[model samples]
Target: MSKEICFIADSSGGLPREILERHQIKEVPFYFKFQNTDYYCENVDYTGSEFYRHMEKNPEDVPQTAAPNVNDWLGALEERYVRGAKNFIVTTISSRLSSSFQTASLAKDVFAEQHDDVQVEVIDSNTCACGQASLEIAIAQMIESGKAFREIVDRVNQAVGSVTTLFVVNNLKYMEAGGRIGGATAFLGKLAQIKPVCEFIDGAVRPVKAVIGRKNSLKTMMDLAISRVSDWSRLIVTVQNAEFSEDADYAVDYLRKAASYSGKIYRSDLGVVVGAHSGPGAAGIGLVEASPLLR
Candidate 1:
């Protein structure tokens, strides 16, 4: 691990444990209130998919996820700072989806107030899950190559603009309840039995199109994601799902047969906080054109 810099992200990214350990990435936990009585910390008490599975039994739960406060972010940064890392790169979920970005920025401000000789750069990745993980991995590579902190920060922001997350939403009710979509829009989509394709654009989830069925929606998402790829020579494709691993596997197979990518394919789950808004049965293809410091 580089003692000069540290990389941190909220747990909503659902980054694999191996990657987190290998990259020395620190994850700040997000919280969710279960049954209006119990509080569960995401990735600590349960995962993204696990949340949906529990919801299956209840069937009437509305998600109430909370972002880590300034203190939580401060504590995470302080831990790394105490370990001799003067530079911190904090990545948060889209500012639109959650207030994590703003909270993390506040924490950075607090760190700056106390420490005169440290750098903290927080990025609103405008994405979550696989998309966020891609950005984290790329920054880790940059750190390992001994890149300057400023260069890595610039690269991180540039990479955020390159994130394309095309998702298949099985139901729109969850989005509507979470304020991601309007009631009329969700009503109309469900009324027609339409499987919607949503895109994470400019830190907001917007409807892209309507596909015929769930299977077709999965194919359409993958097709759209691959079609938009500027180049495959430096690309990372991730297929992630919320309680739908079989569909994720199918999407991966389709990606393999469709085109050749130099970078690897990641299989991941949407995090609990994100999954609550996206809802169960949501699957997505995260396509990131690489900005790497070391191959």
Candidate 2:
């Protein structure tokens, strides 16, 4: 008998509508709050570019984001289950970065209790935005290829270690407001025009290097990403931007010239959830090895 697997991810994944519709993937939106007004990330009311436009006008008002409600996850799971999905593979942003993973896990438990015949697995992507999206895409493909649940889970776990995410923000103020950097550090960095290159370390975003300009910051980020990949021929890259399409385009061009990857390079918006904290002019690259390295 064939298994019906349902794929779900949070809005933080930054997956495009085509992928969602094509793969039948369900997304739970995160909540964005600006000046006491709440906006849903998945809703049509606010888009990533619109959110950045609002921020440009109210530079002082920092937007905040909240994970999807537990009920949202439960609803998604139950709805799909009722539609004849016997297995569920849910992916979310890093557990260290947000509570969505915990929320999804809880929802999975509740869903399993109500439907004892179903199997639900919640994957902590250990990264956000394009990183999560890449994993979701890979998982969906595996499921379509008739991979078993245990095999799919193992592949995802291996992909976690093989993926590398790097990004740079134009303004440190957003990072400071989000508590990713200290006020003093943000102040000093701004004074010196220092741009920090951030990377995911053990599921948490951390500033790994600092450069003098945006140009250098992008170069540093790309270099750091390239250094980690043992073989560029087996690489899948995702370039994400927060209202910085020009820069993202340039980065993609540069990556094409610099790397030897034979896989597809996905371009995506940073999404409102991460864009709220990264602010405008933020660009990132997520690299995933197509084949897992032997341990």
Candidate 3:
């Protein structure tokens, strides 16, 4: 008999609420401290726009984001177990990016000790935001199709390589605060309107393009991403924005026309995982190549 697998991911997965509800996905929240108050974040305390606005008003208050506590994980899992969930797949943001994967791993061991009969697989998605969302969405489809547990897990592990995550930020201040970029480089980027088109290569961010204007940056990012795939129709794509829905709309429109892509695209708000670093007015596009099993 095939296993009845329940899917769980941190808020950073960037899954739209509709998808989350439809799949019965239990997304664990990440914590961010702002003004000495710890906010358990989903789409964030006040959405990306409000958070960024607050950041602008209080430039001194840098939100400190951390992984979910292990006890929190145990409680959530036990809640599901009591209600008949015996198998679970927990996916988290990249290990290189945050301690979410580590926290989930530790929780897995503790959960096992407490409930020896249950099965738990913690997946390090090796990506964040829409990239992580795309992976789990495909996995949920596989589970719905009655795939075995081991096969689904193996596919997700390999599928991480198929996801290409890229984005362009309005400014570099947030990246500088996160220690992803140098203060000097960020200062220069602000002076010249230089938007760095960045990609997650092996779970670490690397600059892929440097366009002068925001619109030009989005176009360049789309071009660079589309060039990597042979058929856009074979991809599961997601457009995630941090207070930049209009720009994300532009990205979706561009992809549809340029790539002849006519598949369902998830429009998501940037969650705390990537948003805390990418900050406001950032737009991200993630493409996941769908294999035969996922299709």
Candidate 4:
């Protein structure tokens, strides 16, 4: 008998609505606390833009994010299993960044024990936002190409190491409030107009380079990312902005003129999970090379 595979991701994966609907990808949402009230990350009650607008007005009370509990993961998996899926491949934000990966793994174990016929595999993307989305999209393509389950799992695991997540914040106040950065660093960065180009290294966010302005920061990130690609034609790129469509548009234009990458460029909102910390006006580029060209 042939096996049916289902793809699942957490809210931090930053997948757009169309991709979610088209691929039939299931999601578990993360929760955030705003002014003592709890709000789910992708809930309709509070949209991404609305979350950012609230944060902008209430700068003192930046929202706090919470990873989905094991029950949440199990619920999503159970629903898919009831719908005739025999195999599940779950991807989540970096384990180092959140407990979602661990929760998903635990849920898989429990669910598999209850249904001996089902198989569940959890992957720690080791990246977030579009980086995670890119990996999920690649796996969906593999599924469409008729790859075996074992081969798909191995390829997805290997692809995690090749994915790159990079971004620049317009203001560091949100980061500082979230305790991701020191207040002194935020203050100094603001004073110097230093927009630091950051990337995920070893599953942690780290500053790679600093530029004087937002435009330069975006360009630097794109140039550095493009320089690492081995095959431009196979490149998968995602451009995202935090309540800043103009900046996202600018990045898309820059990618066309600068990298000359002809592949489809996935564009999405940064989403509230990342947006809460990145703040408004932030923009980023995520690149996943079809094959790694460098160390």
lDDT of 3 by residue, 269-293 (tens): 8887687788778898887877654
Q: Give the per-residue lDDT digits (tens) of candidate 1, residues 1-295.
A: 5788899989877777777888889999999976666778888887666788877666678778899999999999999888888999899999988899999999999999999999999999998877777667777778888988898888777678878878887887888888877888778878778888888888888889888788988888888887898777767666778888899888888888886543588777888887887778888877777744334
TM-scores, all models, native as reference: 0.94, 0.94, 0.94, 0.94
lDDT digits (tens) for residues 165-238 of candidate 4: 88889988887887878989989999999988888777788889979998899889888877777777667788
- Model 2 C-alpha lDDT per residue in residues 206-293, reported as the tens digit of each score: 8899899998899888878878878766566788898878889878877767875456788888877778778889999887776652
Instruction: Tell me the lDDT of candidate 1.
Output: 0.82
Q: RMSDs, each prediction?
A: 1.8, 2.2, 2.0, 2.6
Q: Where in model 2 is the C-alpha error above 4 Å?
A: 1-3, 293-295
State the C-alpha lDDT per candidate: 0.82, 0.82, 0.82, 0.82
Residue 251 error, candidate 3, Å: 0.2
**Which stretches of model 4 miss by more than 4 angstroms?**
1-3, 291-295
Alpha-carbon deviation at 2 in model 1, angstroms: 1.7
Segments in model 1 whose C-alpha atoms lie over 4 Å from true places: 291-295
Candidate 3, lDDT over the whole model = 0.82
Worst 10 residues of 1 by lDDT: 286-295
